[model samples]
Target: MTKSISYRFALCICVLFSVANLSVADTLTVTWTGAIGELETTIMADTSADGTQAHAVYKLESNKTYLQRSTIVLESSCDIVGAAYGTGETPATIQPIPGDDGASQFAGWPAGNIKTYGEDQSYAFKNLLFNGVFADGSTTLFGVLATYGKGNTITVDHVTSVHNQVITYFCFGQEENWTLTNNTAVQYSCYPAGMYFGGFWWGGGGGWTGTVESLLIQNNTIEGAHGQAFVIYDNGLVNRTEGEVINVDHNTFVNIIDWPKFYRHGNNTRWTNNLFVNMAANGQTRNAANTNIALNNDHVGGHGKTATLYQGACTDSTLLADGNCWDRTNRNISYQNNAWMDTPELLDMFAMEPWCWDLPADSNGVVVTLCDTMIANQSKWAGDSTMSMFANGVYMSNNLHMSDRGWNLDPVYITAQTTRTRDWLDNGVHDTHTDHFWMHQADGDKITVEWPLPMDFSYLATSAAATHCTHGGPVGSTHHMDHPAGLTLNTNPDGIVASTFALKQNYPNPFNPSTEISFNLDEIADINLSIFNMLGQKVRTLTNGTKPAGVHTLEWDGRDEMGQRVSTGIYLYTLSNGSKTITKKMALMK
Candidate 1:
């Protein structure tokens, strides 16, 4: 069951999964008992025949720690979910077995902790803790390695990783939908290898192909990462069809040594309502000369670029037939309503550079500025007038940056602050809270009230700025601010227990087709479960009757009483027991 797969073999696997004739779909559940090789053995034995049609759910024992000694190749779609006894109970944990050379079997590509290769499949990992700390500081382990798939839906939700090199890495081909939400990564110090989250070139010359239908990275808390946060790259071959998107929203990134790097995606890419703090820490000099001029503050604090968007070389003329090349204009990328706290003066928020050949050329083949091209193509390039094209095609607005100006009123400090602020303003970045004091916040400058742990970025409630900040709520990630509870397993438990009435968050918040909604009832009571639109109109009543006490779960297939599919938007779900009522929100993203 232990094997290494090459790129060619990986591609073949994807093709095989796509063309294979699957049988009647069935759900298979397996329980683990902390034994070595048993989990993988059970999975392979049960699904050895016609795996594509089987929906396997591998349930790990509650709060137990399991050692993954080798890569587990998933031949089929499945859900690996950990069990918990009750509220505040710890979930099962999976960590790499300690090795002599600090290298575990979960190294990558050829091997990894968990590997899945297929097309048009659904894979979910949830309610589990992954500890990737190694002895010799090896940075090769990938919690989940997925490769070469199209129209695949992958979800990594409610998972926690500690000191992991890469929590998840998707390589080669395109995915219909990929979501990384409600996850927590603590001390993710990976360097000289990979990113904490994203895909990379895996032994290919031209690089990954196809267009991602949708990518959602939301509600995650990344506390400390040494190298990069997200590094998604797409070869400039295919353009996403209209309405496709890559959304990185409502996440908190702090103590990041480097920034997110994205390339050659011409879709509606958005970075919205995110909170960043203490970025570019200790400079971006990773065992090399500090060549970055922006971060040259005697190697103290704030001395690097925040992000870079590159238009990869789209030199293939054959792709031009369908207009499947990198879009140099980058009109669909946007950064809005984001907030940065304790940012240094010189860090450029974003930098966009066209491919070497993508620079505009005149009829005589002479290089010209983007402004020159805009003048020639007036109808095509008409939008923001203030931008000087320094960061072309990027629309930035309503972004807030607050830095502490300490007692040192040096001319260099003042000049750097004003210069960056003016540059942003001139480039069509409209900050609604802009004022004279923004550049000289001597009295107002302060650090987060909850420093280091549970870093709270909420402004004072009395301040008028609080109302304008972050769309009626706080600006940062609201979940898992404090580190997740450590894994503590009770080897012997009486039985399944329920202590309170609770309605848990939906499995996949922005879901397509269907999603699960679960709740706990301490005692038998008459309960009513219904879904309502934003306008307070009830769309469907899932259940309305007396139910016994225990954990109750149901699935909403994104439909109404008339059996017609609902439009994409936020929908409210209410759970009422005649006395106590609990309401929550879920999104149906078609």
Candidate 2:
């Protein structure tokens, strides 16, 4: 009996020990130590109810690579000084003492921070940081400093960095599929950028000369170091030498005066739908073929009077080059009903990069300053090769400088917020970014030419209708051009695109009592207009048939096919041809 009791007690002790160990293993903390290390974590997809990836583990070591196909979380304290724990270097670089700087207790300090390896491995990062390489007097930090041949993918979210020399890039160098969203980057250097902003430290080894190809810079807010401006450069060295595509959309460039310098947005890069205020493109003239529309960017207006607002000079005109084939390119480009505001007092709009589509102009001789500019050109086949200034210039009523803008000619009146101003350049006062401009018609009325109603299409044609004899320029400073002769751009809002199909917002969105929706078909086509609820349930069908395209309006009574009223908090309306479908959201009020 005594022997049996002893055995039972021993077994009980083992069971308790196992449970204790499991509990402790459930939670793990990462910190700096003498040795470089990696914390290998397992990732199981479909563990969550939705069958999407539910959980993952990350392991990385100080000064040692975590290898590829791995993810690790590098965290720093909210304190400015605590940022020191983020980088692989010893915290002594920023905080020589435990609390000397804003460094926090990571259970392991600077020595414990980890680094990653990307080449010949699959690696990714989610919610990571590389922080604190600065003097106690200042914080210098970097986030992720990537250097390697392109391998795997990386993703970072909510990555924050202090504007310090040492702890700079929250996520620095990158290659391949990088999706960085909602990140806050603050840099403070004498020159401001310190080491964090650019991956310059990555050196020249791994094709490090140029910007990463196929990178998406989306939804990020970057604040340049004080006194130091930001410029997005095209690194000549990249994995794919030809046809690289980088998309810089939905991102905010704040306090960054000079725009990215390279004329090519990485071979076939896209710069669209971004907001640029209080900054300038800094003389960066992008080519239409190489760089997509420099579209829908707003000038903050506050910088209008300062030299900071002037974006360098147009040193490159890739858009005008022969490879662009200009109109012959048959390239697909579009605008999303974007808005720009310029006051009535600023002139010299020609200095800005040319917008691919037509811009606003003033009727009634109401001169307006340009918020943006573009020079349309004829197709390469036309052999003229000059930018057609898509507006008519009346030198005291001489249409000699007139170029056609193809949009619906209509009588519309919407007063500009900024009153007309004189242009100092032409011995005429200029307008700000917001003053109203006109296109074909004066006094808000479309020019009637005894032609078809939609003949005033946004696409300018010199009678062939197959070609767009472009809107030329105050061009390369020399202002040399070859087009339909004497065309010049005025501050007009009737630039071709919007006038084609004015897709107005639905009334009483989330609505009832019948809301009116309208559209303009450039030509006849089979079309279907539909309304759907948030759940993707079909709520209403407005129009479905073959119709001549000009301008047409339809009404939705917030009712289903049977004309029965439906409840709604939010609904989506979709328009479709046989092949292309576009859906936009609308709300119903009652």
- Give me the candidate number with maximum lDDT: 1
lDDT per residue (tens digit) for residues 253-358 in model 1: 7655445433224335567667666454323211121222222222222223334334545676755564655555564566677666533332332221211213
Task: Locate the minimum summed-lDDT window of 10 residues in model 2.
Answer: 378-387
The models' CA-based lDDT, in order, is 0.49, 0.31
* TM-scores of all predicted structures: 0.57, 0.32
Q: Give the TM-score of candidate 2.
A: 0.32
Q: How many residue pairs clash in each candidate?
A: 1, 106
RMSD of each: 16.3, 23.6
| lDDT, residue 262, candidate 2 | 20
- lDDT digits (tens) for residues 379-441 of candidate 2: 010111111111111001101111222212131211110112111112122323221121122
Candidate with top TM-score is: 1
